[model samples]
Target chain A: MNPVGRIGLIVTVTAVAIHFTGVAYAQADFEGIWNPQHPPRMGQPDPASVRLTPEGQAEYESYGPDKDPTLRCLMPGIPLGLVDPYPLEIVQQDHQILLLYEHFHQVRRIFMDGREAPDHWLPSIGGYSTGHWEGETLVVRTTLMSPDNYTWTNGFPYSGDEDAYVIERYRRDGDELTFTGEVHDPRYYEEPYVVNGRWNFAPDGEIWEYECIPEFGGIQ
Target chain B: MLFIGFSATAHHNGATYFDISTELEHSDATVVSYDLVNPHGRLVYVFMDDEGNEVEWRAELPSANNARRRGLGGDLFRPGDRLTALTGSPSRSGANFMRLTRVLFANGDVAQITGRNAGVVRAGTE
Candidate 1:
């Protein structure tokens, strides 16, 4: 083909790729404004799993509320953000999932859609989350976390171990998409810990940045 | 994950009280039929079924000062019992994870491992 013709073809191909990428992001829940349709807050609360035994209670009590992670601006990490009742925008890519949260505007990247979990994984604040489709759910299993960064808002909380698995089941019915998760901490809980909540889709919802500022003296 | 059946009760602001401790421990909870929203200041929350969905509660974090010594004793469950809970704390949506501050059990029993008693154990030599 002539130089002019070849140039036009390349441009056309690039445009097609870009258009497809935009379409893909537009179709995902992670990329739009999402509000918690059913969160486990105390009043008419929706909680995660509950299996904190007496022993588990003892251990957890030692780590009581004053040291709550949210009191600080620490990252809520991977699957934790999914249930944290914050609006998050997902910047989806062919190989990675960028989880953006409204809580702190914290963003987590998961290499889903066929990328290998990193070897020599670093102990992360949120760790790492990888996902794929299992029928209607996008099953995600996370690993490589340091138990020091998370908080337990229910019967039992994640202790940041290899055995601690966070599973996310996401599905959409009509305009709203629902994502539920189960956190299993074998050492803490006596059974398969499960928690449930839902989301309301806001196609027009916009993501605002989260800026956490520490109290200068006694002010939060 | 399973959605355990919720205990039916009424609370303030048209909120219904439900115990998820049993659900988390024993029964598989179905979708929690409640309003989910952006957590204003929650330490942790869970994604029951939505990708960006979250819920808050009471929990014990690692910073409770003297937790390592106050270890878990007498297994609370036998691997198949259900435990559900409810929390007042909301999730901090911008963090790496969510937290539930004060955890309660299925039978209206709140978890308390706060080491009302304290002791220590020596490491055994191999």
Candidate 2:
């Protein structure tokens, strides 16, 4: 081959390799066990900051620790489950991401296969999650949560109806993971509820089995 | 290495059951039973009142796993083990219940069971 032709081919191959490497880097790797770097403070929103509607205000007023579903061993659901003071494992696959929490043995699957919620889907505590990657952050949108659940911020208020939804952004930087979320429920609040949390990579961390028996202490 | 940042935020709100602002102390308490379980660990013990009457108290500790990591074992407090000091938040309902915070073993060891200073154990008399 001519010298100029050989040089051109080499340049083309190197450019292709670099491009693929950039693509791989863009797909952040968040698969590992993570221990919370700080306490997961989900529902501790400032009462003055939260703009609750009349229904939400009424529900907040009626809130009591005795009525906390968690005391009954009910699943804490989204923001609460995500911020619990326990270790969690993140497993990423080509089509979905799985979050395995040591709290209440909760497991959440975030579908990435471009699927939509069924028209007649039943609401659940964990709800339905769909995720996509933008740059190095994983953005997830969750909906169809059960209305029976509670949102703990300034006060423990009932979660809004089926229309309640949550949007979460997860970004990993070195050994640190940052999470930000927005809870939207027009029925409950005049503004979206926002929360932030952080976790550190636990190289030797393991998720243990969680068996919640509400009658353990006989206090209830 | 010890893991920190496991906050006091557990399954239920502690304020609902205990008066967190007040601290109650029991010295030379005899352990009746210790159930190391999830959600929270319960420690039942008996101490003498000012009138020399035996009083039974139930104190809540962290989960079994968190307790283990903080140097508490199932056998750490046996049926007859004596605690040099047991301090916690008293129950608001006027019951003999508390949210355990610090435990001082008869041998001088100390375990901070909850709060910002949780997961710390100081060896004593070894």
Candidate 3:
């Protein structure tokens, strides 16, 4: 082969590699502002139908909207914030995924770089997330959530299991994103509870501050 | 027609405090102020009762961000602006707590302020 032809072949191969590399990184794009196509209800079986354990039943009976921490301008926590009515923005990077929720101005981080969650960690509102891509789907395992957080605004509380784990699956299509979560709480729930929601890609939407100040007190 | 005649409500424990199945009769009111806050917003206004006594009513709304998306702001209703409001039933029988659904200003302007749940006819449009 001529020397000039050999150089041309090398250049062509390099260009192809670069093009495919870009596509590989782009295959798992979850970056965008999104809102549910239809507003989502809390979780499966309705609160009226949920079979709570004795302790959970008592907590359910005693709790009311007045006792809701959100009334005090506190974070709604984990699954609640995940499906908040306001728009949510997802920013993806090589090693991390950042979620900015317009509600409560909550920011959540999901580690993407092969880092495992600590065996023992403090509880938090958004909890600790470690995510990996399964084909086009993003699967996240979150734990260490604050026990004080209620699963729903309607007074249904989580079982507060220190080992309570939440598994969430996120998938994105052309203009739609779907999220499904499973709460494994052996302490207070008769069985694993499921929560699912759908969000559409909102290119024109922007996240806004939902500052919950303490001064407002009518419903609290 | 894909999106018409459908009402969307924001995320809140509405069923916890308000009767989702009941709606109050439309009332004639004069606006006092608009409280755009988190968790929910409140519309403060007064109306004349059947006994001709002044009654102050507080109507709950969606969060400020939802309201902003719906084109509602603190300046939408002035203190003396006369409006007809369609409200939802209150949890308490006599309490003035109600969910503001639609509002019609006397000046030929009709605005539907239903949060999360919209698509109802404007109060005077029907």
Candidate 4:
């Protein structure tokens, strides 16, 4: 073939390759608004059921309602926000997964671009999250969370702070998504605490804005 | 790097605001008003004391978003509407303050406004 014919064939092959790649990424559909099956606030776990260290037990017992930081309009951190009453939206891209919770308008990003956690990074309430897909399940690992943050509400300490670790597995079955999370904090619990919940897909549902007005009863 | 707006609303520890150890006093009262605002919803009502004197009661519920989701909106109540409430026992023996439990409207409408124990009421409260 002539030079022009050869160039035309190369362009056609490149276009086909790009189209197939786009289709491959689109196959993982975890995007949409979802509501947890049961949003747990109170009656989550009895103190006896939680295996706490001596220091952890003292911290939990010292939690005073008036001194609660969340009442002052602070972040409730992980697991608590995961099963909030308001719906959360999941937006997946090639490089990351974004979680947008309706309550307090919290947003969490799970990087999927093959980056390792940085050393001596600043602690964050949302922590540093990295995710990978295992077949249909998306497993996420989060670390470097702020020590001041609470793993579960009511003063469940996440004292691990810089060393705090969280692993979450998200699996989608039809329109229902299940979240199984494990939190490990050597400074708090004697063992990893498990968190389980479900979210149903809501195509037409929208997570309304949660504008917190202090002194107006900002509970969560 | 994309951060979405987060409002510090909903999911506060109820134990801090309420005395959960004591039983909620189930009483029949009249809906004086309901402020369906953000942060939290307030329900104002009046009930009769042991001596038959009128006692005003103000209770807090979940956020407007959760209330709206449970079919309890601004239009749900009006002044003079009869309601059955499970009120939180006051910290002091005779304090007039009461926290709210599930609310039963005169029209047979029931809402678990407290945001917990959904669809399940105390064995005898229902």
Candidate 5:
């Protein structure tokens, strides 16, 4: 059970906060300053990504969806790399915005500068994301993500390691901004997986300083 | 401190604490180096570095082929088939507790280790 789910206030406060942002938050407006938070809860499961082959099913069954190796501050590997349950700062400059997740001091620098991705050797974690603006929407295509699907403790399997791609269409509809992510992993996936995630920009906040120290336990 | 979550977690590399690094400068003990005696049964232990160079140590760990030994990834050794291995030591002088992150051999070879079992409690000189 989610700790904050009991409060009921977080949902109200978060929704109200999103409501006050006026109209919708466009990509350029959100490019400057933003704080991201993922409270502990079982959000909507993307069934589109759930369709896997027998081998893929085996991998996903090995662990639950929340495979948090970093629970004890262990090494954070593929998947939980960005979807950490904490507030992160998103700093946008020109076409580039930096995503800094607080789980284990992990940060990913996304390039909006239209450069071609390298050869077939990029490993997935956050993957390689390049963004482009279409009117008020920021369209980002992320490739090179390592495929397996148990980032923390959850054992959800992505389609495949080599052929997975995420097309994130970020739209700011007034105070409520929506991020529609499409996952395409060809090996195990028979079709394109889609997820429409929504968020509110918290300007009245600061990204909490999170540090993971596992030297003694060496858990991280 | 692993965090738990369900569906929709971006399946990327979960954060590991190895890179962030810790200060680890604790002033809790009055003296620095204290002897570590085993609280459990006797243990045959050896202190090895990353290069597998055996360093002089107090505890005695058993052989790798021992019936009670378990291997973590990269040749890390564990006793009792669990992440926490209780090696053979004398009485309690101090404790050498370690997380199951990595283990070093007498020849200085290092292996991955984890679990919060390596402890070194401070002991007042008898």
Candidate 6:
């Protein structure tokens, strides 16, 4: 190769290597068993603060406790799973981060390899999560969530379509971890629904198995 | 030690089945059976009413894993075990159902099953 070409190639490789090294050093250590400081509220938004669309209001009014997905042993999904009262273990890796929850043994994978969601990806309870580090905070964006029939703590209904998305920021400080999330569903709400929660590091905490059995007899 | 507080409406809506605003106490209750299962634990017992009728009731306790963390074992209560006082919230629909909060054994031991007073199981004097 020519001298100029070799110089340009060496400079490009060095810049890419420095960028990756910076990301590695800037990554915060969130690896630990975290116990929620407060009981899980199932990502319930205050009805007074939430401005729902006409369709959303109708769905909310029609919600009943019997329609809860958890009663049928289905995963609560996304923000609900994230804020569950059970302990969760965060396993950080180069390509992805794994969130192992004790609530029904749900596992969430947050890809950090800069891959975009596929066009024809199937919607699911946990959805698809892509995470990137911004300073010391881990920012996660999830999309393509299935609109399962479930009611929030205050009877607010989840009626979003596949376009519904959630953005979360996880910040770790010492032994405390704070989380803030915003749910965006233009079809359901006029504004993004916001929620906040916190967790404390449990050095001796361990995730226990959660076995759920649906009570068909009790379902009416 | 991390103490996970038990919410009455944790898994499902407690208000739909339970009259959470009121508390009921059943004295001298006899255990019919105890099932340590998921979603919630079931404690079936029979108690004599004011009319001298033996009425069977079902009390929903915390999940088995939560009970274990609170020092309660699967074999804690067996059939025919006598309880001095079994306290909980009664069903809103007037069914034979309850949301268990505490259990006082005949031997003077106390087990605070749920709510703010949970996680305390005192030794019996006997």
C-alpha RMSD over true interface residues, each candidate: 13.2, 4.0, 2.9, 4.9, 15.7, 4.0
Q: Which segments of model 6 are wrong by more than 4 Å? A: A1-11, A17-26, A39-49, A149-154, A216-220, B1-17, B92-94, B123-126
Error of 3 at B24 (Å): 1.5
Per lDDT, what order, best first?
Answer: 2, 6, 3, 4, 1, 5
Chain B TM, every candidate: 0.29, 0.81, 0.74, 0.70, 0.20, 0.83
lDDT for residue A90 in candidate 1, whole number 0-100: 63
lDDT of each: 0.47, 0.75, 0.71, 0.68, 0.43, 0.75
- DockQ of every candidate structure: 0.02, 0.22, 0.32, 0.28, 0.04, 0.28
Give the per-residue lDDT digits (tens) of candidate 3, residues B1-126: 011132435335766666666566546888888778876777788888778888887887767777777777767766787876545555544477676666667655566666444433444566
What is candidate 6's lDDT per residue for B1-126, written digit by digit as tens?
011233354333565556666677888999999987666788889988988999998888877777777777788799999999888877666687888888888877888887444665667432
Question: How far is B103's C-alpha from truth in model 3 (Å)?
Answer: 1.8
The C-alpha RMSD in Å for every predicted model, in order, reads 19.2, 6.4, 6.5, 8.8, 17.5, 5.2
For each candidate in turn, the TM-score is 0.52, 0.83, 0.82, 0.76, 0.48, 0.84
Q: For model 5, how does the per-residue alpha-carbon lDDT over B7-101 read when each residue is reduced to its tens digit?
A: 22222221121111221111111111221111111222343444656533322221111111234221233332121222221112223421122
With a 3 Å backbone cut-off (N, CA, C), the pairs that clash in candidate 3 are B8-B116, B8-B117, B9-B116, B9-B117, B10-B116
Any residue pairs clashing in model 4, and if so which?
A104-B6, A104-B7, A105-B5, A105-B6, A105-B7, A106-B6, A220-B10, A220-B12
**CA-based DockQ, model 4:** 0.28
lDDT, candidate 5, A139-211, per-residue tens: 8777777653443344545643666777777777766656656667666445555544455676774554444
- Report the C-alpha lDDT of model 6 over A1-220, residue by residue, as the tens digit: 9999999999999989867653333379999899867534434454588998898888777766466676677788864555666688999987788889888899998888777788878888888998999999999998877777332544555554766788999999999988888887777688877877788999999999989877621323
Q: Identify the leading candidate in terms of DockQ.
A: 3
Which candidate do you rate higher for DockQ, 2 or 6? Answer: 6
What is the lDDT, from 0 to 100, of the residue A13 in candidate 1?
A: 100
DockQ of 6: 0.28
State the lDDT of candidate 1 residue by residue for B54-87, as single tens digits: 4422222222222222443223323333346433
lDDT of 4 by residue, A1-220 (tens): 9999999999999888766553223235789999767435422455457888899899888865544444556666664454555688999888788999887888898888667678866777777888877888888898877766676666676775556699998898999988788888877889877767678899998989877655656232
